[model samples]
Target: MASIQFKNVVKKYIQGKQSLQVIHGVNAEIADGEFIVIVGPSGCGKSTLLRMVAGLEEISGGEISIGSRVVNKLEPAERDIAMVFQNYALYPHMSVFDNMAYGLKIAKVPKDEIKARVDKAAGILELGQLLDRKPRQLSGGQRQRVAMGRAIVRQPQVFLFDEPLSNLDAKLRAQTRLEIQKLHRELGITSLFVTHDQVEAMTLAQRMIVMNAGNMEQFGTPEEVYSRPATTFVASFIGSPPMNLLKNAPGGKPGQLLGIRPEHLDIGTEGWSLVVDTVELLGAERLVHARVGDELVIIRTHEDQGAPAIGSTIRAKPREDRQHWYDASTGKRVGP
Candidate 1:
């Protein structure tokens, strides 16, 4: 386990007298055994940042350290980091045991120690029985487990996961997420996971870094990013169904934009008059898509709760003090 620190790190790609900056002077501190997830849309440089930490991408400026060692100049292998890729990247012909043991073998670890580590990781990932199977013989979830097992055997200072579950089905993704959380608890290895999925970041991260356009937008606990967004981009990006932002609405006070989560907006008889456009019943809950003033807002409610008919007007407001204010010009959060 190790504490990871990034001190004003920057990365730029040079192309024929032109330089495109991908990461702009980012700084962060991750405590030992902490799970940090970097999340953002594509082209936001979240993956680039994670690769830098793993020593896969060179830092253009500033420093990166693992534990007490500055690893900016260290080779990826010497950085003592294990990365699990999105594609799993397992050899097609190798058995699971061999795949997991390859790293330890290359490092020239004792055979007995390699056996011990492989067995432990396979057991933790519930892949022990499939150790003799090749990548072609396993399902997507199984293949993902092998990738994780490969990383665990290294017992590196930090574990890096680059969208490791994106290839799985929804059910498999959720189940794998639980498995990962359990594995993290069991091993307590410092982990940095990068994903574009807000759900994964919210569920897996003790802390999350939200990046946008080559810059750090917000870094905080999932709750902080959701409940009190530091920026409008964060408020919009971090939630499922996304937060509803209403501009120029007639309310208690004049505001540029009002942000509220779908779950917080209630179907009521006394608020902004909304023209119900659609109601999507989702088993235990429903997502009501409607128009409030000139803005589209989504309201989530229990499945038992009824929604107004299409083309009908209804009243809606936040269930609690869940409204957020954002500056119209800068898209930054303002006073509630």
Candidate 2:
């Protein structure tokens, strides 16, 4: 295992005479054996950053280090890293055992050692029974496991996953996530996973790097990012249903935005008066969508609380302790 470092890493695309910058200066230190997820929306450069670390993309400026050595110019094979792509890149004609052993065989490893390594990886991934099957004979989840097992047998210093769960069904995705957590616990290899799903980032990351428009928005634990976001973008992006950012909220302050989560607002007889617009039933909870002085706000309530009538005037109170303040002009957190 090895620690990775990014120092003012930048990426730019040069076409003819014009240059378009995609990745701004990003700096972070990843500890040895730590699992970090790079998350953002599509076209946000999350995958580009991961590709840079894997030696698959050229760095426009700054440097990347693996362990104590600079790897900015190293070939992908020389970086001692293994990559699992979104698609399961398995050999269709080969059995699982042969597919997993191909890398070691190409490297001229002893035949006996290759067998041992393949066997160990298969055991870890629970693919020992399916080793005799070809790629056509395996299910989607099984094929993905074979891909992971292929990576594991190489014993790389770092693991790079580029939205590896994007193709799996929802149920299989959840199951594979747990398997990955177990794999990391047992092997403890340094890993960097890239995805657009915030839930994946929150659940699988030891620490996460949130990216937006080629710039890193925040880097911290899931708790920190969710509880105290650094900017308005993070506050709105990290949560389900998103936090409400009100410009003309009650107790108005010029050039300031009041931010509050849906769960933090309580429906009551006093406080800000709002007209209910719509309500949604989501199994155990109900979401109240209301308008207050031309601004929309969503409040989360238990199903037992009963949904308010549409167009009915109601009062909802924002929790003083849970309120967030932001600078409307800059979209930045300003006060506690």
Candidate 3:
């Protein structure tokens, strides 16, 4: 295992005489055996950053190091890293054994060692029964496991995963997520995973780097980023159903935005009377969609609790300490 460190890294693509910067100056340290996830919306440069670390993309500036070795100019193969891509890039013609052995063959490892490694990885990934199967014969989740097993068998210094679960069905994705977590726990390899899914970032990462528009928005543990967002974008993006962001509220500065999670809000007797625009009754929870002063807000509550009728006025009460204050102009968090 190896620690990965980025020092003021940047990437820019030049197309048609236009230099579009994809990654701004980013500096972060990912410890050895740590599962660090890079998360953001599409085109936010999370994948670019991961590719840079994997030696797949050229860095425009700054330094990158795997362990103590600077790898900015090293070939992808020379970086001692194994990467699992979004699409399972398995060999359809080769059996799973041959596919796993191919890397060892290229590296010229002893045949016996290669067999032992492949067998161990296959057992860990539960792909032992499908070793003879081709990529086309395996299910989506199985193919994904094969991809992971390929990475594991290599015993590289770092493991890189690029949205490895995006191709699977929702149920399969969740299952595979747990499997990946288990794999990480068992192997304890240094990993850098890139995904646009915040839930995956929150669940898989010991620490995560949240990026936006090529800039590092926040870098911390999942709890810190979720409970104490550094910016309005993070507060709004990280939560399910999103945090209700309201502007022009009393006790806040002019144009300042106040953000509160849906669960933090409650229906109370005395507060802002919002018009119920829509009501969605989920089995366990009810999403009371309402309009408050031209802003659409969603309140999440238990299904057992009665909600205000549609078109009826419901008082929207805010949570005191849970409220997030953001600067009106910059959109960055203003206070604790």
lDDT by residue for model 3 (282-332), tens:
889999998887888899999778867899998878888899889878989
TM-score of 1: 0.96
> What do the candidate models score in CA lDDT, each in turn?
0.90, 0.94, 0.91
Model 1 scores a C-alpha lDDT of 0.90
lDDT per residue for candidate 2 within 294-318, as digits (tens), equals 9999999998899999999999999
Candidates 1 and 3 compared by TM-score, better number: 3
lDDT of 1 by residue, 16-126 (tens): 999999899999999999999999999899999999988889999999999999999999988889999999999998999999999889889999999999999999999
Q: What is the lDDT of residue 197 in candidate 3?
A: 92
Q: Could you tell me how far off, in angstroms, the CA of residue 299 lies in candidate 2 after the best superposition? A: 1.1
Q: How many residue pairs clash in each candidate?
A: 0, 0, 0
Error of 1 at 228 (Å): 0.8
Model 2 per-residue lDDT at 125 = 95
Range of the 10 consecutive residues with the lowest summed lDDT in candidate 2: 327-336
